[model samples]
Target: MKIKTGRRVASALGGAALALGITLGTAGTANAWTADWETVDDGHGVGIYNGPSSTSGKHGFHDLYTPDEVYLICWIRGEDIANQGNVWYRTSEVYYYRIGSYNLWGNYYVYGAYVDNYYAFHHRLDECKS
Candidate 1:
């Protein structure tokens, strides 16, 4: 009878240890947020600016992307600018800056306008359904 009681206690302790191990293994893992992309409107090439507005300095390297070009939309913000209230989409692509006369590529902001009169961006909610 004592042997059976000892075996049951050992088994319970082993199960508890296994559960604790599993919890600790997954504790450090995190889920990062991913974004979608949008294309430029027809006949209107979008400029990947250095900041959120047109007045906020331009990146001097790449030319304007054509209407066929697509860009990743990471986030959206609304602010009053360019004599009107505008909503801007923060793109995933980084813009470069010029230091005096040299161009340096680093992490920079590129915002695209989401005007109601133009189809500047598009996304399918069905794609996120899994």
Candidate 2:
């Protein structure tokens, strides 16, 4: 009886150690936010905005050409374009035609209608606050 009780106690401690090891191994190694890539509308490069709306003014401002990919950060509701949904995506970076890729400093917006996956990310992306 004594031997069986000791075995159970050792097994429980081993399980706890394994769980803690896993938790510590992954700590601080994951990104705080999720990101994905979406291609720009073919032949129609779009402008990057400072805010969710076009009227928000351009921030770190630049244009993204068709075939160019935008690294999406998140989305928010904004002014409508071409009668399309009033949605816009916040992008982190863009590539210029003649220049190399540039980082938008993380505070820029692109009209959803201008991206190929405009409809696909509506539910997948986390909405921007305010």
Candidate 3:
């Protein structure tokens, strides 16, 4: 009986240890930037905007993505622009370009509409995975 009790205690301790380890491991990853990373939808193009609004200028990067482009969406802001209530996603990728004589590369915003539109889609980096 003593031996059986000892084995049961050891098994319980092992199970507890495993649960704690899994909880800690997942907690660490929960804080990772990849947790905020989202993929762009297939066949849709998003644009990196100069600002959260659709009226904001488009940076010169102009690289349209086909699909599954991973981007870190730091936050979202609500703005009334482009005749629709827009949810803009702020990202980490920098948009590079030159304005006449000056060169610049910086992070930009993209409108959600661009991500949903069928044609003329500009993959800016705002659309989140569905």
Candidate 4:
């Protein structure tokens, strides 16, 4: 009976430590910029102006962006993309993908899957941006 009680206490401590580590890993120190992101209204529908607010929308997506950070938008650039097309325009270069639904904020790799709710996916993320 005593051994079982000891095991439960150790398990609780371990679980608490694991949760704390995950929470700390996802956050960063304070900065002038807002951790909460916003979408830019450029008359291009879902296009976002991600530059630092202090810069007046210049020199953005060029510096100060982390790879793990993700944003969603819908816009037309260069050629018209196909349903399965994955191409990058000016921002974020060739790595950008027009994804649907499933969140890829954790370096998710996708292949050979057809998504029906592309617009809905964008709308979901766009609304989250405030």
Q: Residues 1-130, candidate 4, lDDT per residue (tens digit)?
A: 7544543454344335434433222322222121122222222222213221222243222222112112222122222234544321112211212221112122111111112123323433221121
How do the residues 66-107 of candidate 3 rate in per-residue lDDT, one tens digit apiece?
432323333355565656555665543421212222212244
Q: Which candidate leads the pack in lDDT?
A: 2
Q: How do the residues 36-98 of candidate 2 rate in per-residue lDDT, one tens digit apiece?
A: 556677756687887668788875445776655565656777898778788788665554433
* TM-score (all chains, Cα) for each model: 0.40, 0.61, 0.42, 0.18
- List, in order, the clash count of every candidate structure: 0, 0, 8, 0
Cα-based RMSD of candidate 2: 16.2
Every candidate's lDDT: 0.36, 0.58, 0.41, 0.24
On TM-score, the leading prediction is: 2
Which residue pairs clash within candidate 4?
none
Sequence-dependent TM-score of model 1: 0.40
lDDT accuracy of residue 96 in candidate 3 = 22
Model 4, position 78, has a per-residue lDDT of: 25
CA lDDT, candidate 4, residue 59: 27
Could you give the C-alpha RMSD of every candidate to the true structure, in order shown? 19.6, 16.2, 17.4, 15.9
Whichever of 3 and 4 has more lDDT, that candidate is: 3
Question: Which pairs clash (backbone N, Cα, C closer than 3 Å) in model 2?
Answer: none
